[model samples]
Target chain A: MTPILIALTIGIPWLGAIIVWLMGDRREDLTHWVSILFSIGAAITSVLLLPNASQETALTIPIGGDFGDFTFVADGLGIFLSVIAAVIGSLAVIFSKSYMKGEGSLGRYYAFVLFFIGAMVGLVLSSNLLLIFLFWEITALCSYALISFHNDDPKAVKGGIKALIITSIGGVGLMVGALIVYAYTGSYDINNFLANYSTIPGNILALLAFGFLIAAAAKSAQFPFQTWLPDAMEAPSPISALIHAATMVNAGVYLLARFYPAFKDVPYWSEAVMIVGALSALLAAVMALVSNDLKRVLAYSTVSQLGYMVYAIGTGSVYASQFHLFSHSIFKALLFLSAGAVIHSIGTRNMLEMGGVGKKHPLVKWVFIIGALALAGLPILNGFWSKELILESGLKNGPLWLYIVMVFVAGLTALYTIRCVWLVFFGEPRSDYHAHAIGWEMIAALLPLAGAALVSWLAAGRFSVLLGEKSLPFHAIEPLPYKEMMHEILSLPTLVVMAVITAAILLWVFRKKLEGLINGLKSIRWAAENSFGFEAINNAIVKVTQSTAEALRVTQTGILNWNVFGILASVILLLAILVLGA
Target chain B: MNLPIPLVVLITILCLAGIGLYCLLITRNLIKVVIALQLIVKGAVLAFILAGNMTGQLNLAQSMALTVIVADTIVAVVGLALAVQIRLKTGSLDIKSLSSLKR
Candidate 1:
């Protein structure tokens, strides 16, 4: 029965992809309905598996031979991530019905989206490392294809290629780690490797540990790889909500948390993960503070939120990280979709072009504010609880200095969230842009997420029980009861942070008198806008690859015989080497 | 172990393959390239037959050789047709002049 549920969760969306793709762009209405129905079906199936979440393996299919067994585990971690992917994926699809109403190539859009959701589900549920890698690449492919869905635009095409190349570098890290595990254990089973990884030598284990760190950093858009995600805003708004905000980026944090127990004791590994997360959170928050583009701000915020999760894992708190992942997924998806609603209506993504939009679209205004309040870690919202938990874990288990830096980053997060809300909704109209009315489809999607942002933290006890205490063995902190946790979160330091946020907002409101002081910070703003030259370095790497490819193009003379000659020569050379070696 | 017949046949096939490769690399006319490709196929066929005879699988080799012949003939016919089309379109059959297709 568990296996059947897993199959339905993965297979239904894939089947929907094929069916909608065949329906073609001419039948846009049918394609939209079919995609929504199938995605919701997957969502329901994943929810049905929640009660069965445990340490035991749910199902296995023996492929025989060297490939090893394909297994699926309904463990707490796997089932939780699958539920996030399926549920948020369904909401994104429903929002797209109105968001992508008149867009051509509707079939292609729906197909790539459905395929991506299925791949994400398969990725989380699979217990085999090789099978996980396969699904990982599939998600990357779907992201690339969907990012470039508007292929007529050169920027969209460039964004897609950049995303593909950067993420593929991470893919190599994961592949190498998988191969090393296979070499040492003679199997691709993740549970088998995790149970016996210590028997492998120390140096190889270190290599695997750091290799996976690089993989997670690259995939999650931490540090140097963080630049591509902001550019990924060239994709449509719904795709941004679905892939960039809700699911794909979270996979990296998921990978780190999943392997934390095995790699925690590797010397300096935890500290390095902490530094990466801390730096990403700080840098992205700074960048978000300066961005004028609406979606780009959310994109940077997603990177920062993911950094917090990674930092939680680094602090030896898997429960903190996974719980944060849960809260962040709901609120971020809500924020992005609300931003989508605004963008869809105003026909622009520039915040400077939008002002007092709240007065025009009151529903969108309120929903965006709910998401912002949650994002700012205000009291009683979901982000506040999970974030305070991460801070508590960090202080207790990790370095003191890094925990302080993260708290400062949380303030920065609040500052940006307030700035974003004020710029878009509070000030007088800044540009002459007529806004469209919010549709029922968009409203239906945003309401549930807004509700979740307010109440999902109430499930903290259940989340802890689901993710058993033994999940993090090395630095396992005792789970706090809900009432006590809430009391601690509303203490003195929380009041101080809230007060600081309010003061910052008031200062921004009266900034006309502080023009001189604002001018003094021009250099910092310039650095923030440039992403501190990280984008330049990433661009250089891409340029080098393109030039190298261009130089190699000379080998293809386009004469058929030349190509055949090249192939035959290579074949002969390989044969001679084999014969000589034998 | 001194199997002279098989050894000589193997050497002959290798020589044919070498000559065909040389023509493929150095030839200027498109038609000569097609003939060189056929030479390579013929060498492979001869080697298969020799291996089959030595290993007592003559009937299998013969059937494989017949299939190869049919495939090679079809390829040759298509290659000639494409070459003729190129000649008519561009008024030249020199392989070097086909650099127009290069980026």
Candidate 2:
């Protein structure tokens, strides 16, 4: 049953891709229906499979002799992520129906989205390291294709290429770590590696651990690799929502959480993870505050939110990390889709061109506000509970200094969230762009997510149990009366933190009078806008890698026959060494 | 005390690899590079066959060799296609001409 569900989890979208592709460029309705139904099926199966999965329920299919197994697991962690990928994926597809109506190449759009969904599911479900790498690369490919979906736009193509190049560097980390594990354990089975990894040398273990860290950082857009994501806003807003909120970027956090049990005990790994997350969170938040492009602002916000999840993992709050993942996916998707509706109506992502839109488009206004409130960690919203849990865990388990920094970062999050909302929706219309109302499909996509953002905190206990952290004895430091079971979030400290976050929001809202003081600290503003010069450093590394690849490309010698000969000769030489005396 | 046919095959494979390496090192033409790559693949397949003969593990070697064949074939196909594209687009096959990547 588990294998069947796992297969459905991955296969449904793949099958949908084939069907959508088969329908070709002509049949839009059939393609849309096929994609929608298949995505829904995938989501339902993920939800149903969650209850059956233990920590060790894996399905392995024999690939061939000696090449080892292609495996999938329905673990609590994997199943939880599958639910996010499938659920948010289906909503995006539904939203895309109205958003993509009459746009060029509906068939191709649905095909790639389904392909990406399948790849994401495969990534989370795979229990073989080799298989995981295979799925990981596939998601990168799909992301590239989808981001470049409007292929005529040079900026879109460039954005897609940047995503491909940067994420592939992360892929190198995954592949190297997998190969090292296989070299040590003599099996590609992930469970085998997890069980026997400690028997390997400490230095080698550290190397593997760092390799995965690089992979996660690059994939999740931590610090140096973070620039690619904001540029990726050139993709359609729905794809941005999917990649940023639900699918691609989440792969990084998933990798960290999945392997935390093994690498948690390794010295330096947790600290490095924590520093990377904190720096990214703080840096990206400031960038988000200053960005004028609405989608780019949200893109930076996504990076910042991912940093919070990464920071949670670093502080040993795996449950808090994953719980935030669930909440963040809902609100962020809601935010992106609402932003999409606005962009679609006004034909601009520039917030300066988008003032007073809320007064006209009540649906988008309300939904965007819900998303913003949740993002700001206001009371009764899901983000508040999970984010506070992470901060609490940091205070208890992480250093006090780091906890204080995160708390301040939370305030920055609230400030930017309010600032973004005010710039887009409130005040008078600032530019010539005409504001229009949203359609029913747009409303349909957004309303449920707003509800989810409001209510997902109800599942915090289940999250704690799934992450294996519920047994830890700890104090509930909140003063408000939170329910011990379902409504377990209302506490005094939470209310105080909320008060601080709200205060930050009020300060940013009134910054015009404070402009003199802000200008006095212009260097800090400049560093934040430029990502503290990290962007320049990252660009240098990419440039070096490109030149090196070009230099290596010189070896390819344009002749096809030589390539064949080189392959044959290398094969022969290796055989000679194995079969004959030295 | 036996000199097997496969042992002779193994030595021939090494000789071919050495020749391929010499060609790869000395040649300036991209075409020659492909020929060298093909030679390497041949050497690899020959080695796999020899190993299978020695260990009596025919299936494993064949499967692994099949993957090698797939990779080599892909390189050959894509490399030729790209070469033609570059030649048509830039009107040359010279590796120096490809250096326009610097821009």
Error of 2 at A577 (Å): 14
Cα RMSD (angstroms) for every candidate in the order listed? 2.8, 6.4
Candidate 1 lDDT over residue span B1-103, tens digit each: 5778878898889999989988888787889989998999999999889988989999999999999999999999999998999899888888877787665
Candidate topping DockQ: 1
List model 1 lDDT by residue over A403-517, tens digit each.
8888888888988998899999987999999998877999999999999999999998888777775232332445667887777677766665667667666667787998998
Whose TM-score is greatest here?
1
Worst 10 residues of 2 chain A by lDDT: A470-479
lDDT, candidate 2, A180-226, per-residue tens: 98899998887777777789898898998889999998899897689
lDDT over C-alpha atoms for residue A79 of model 1: 86
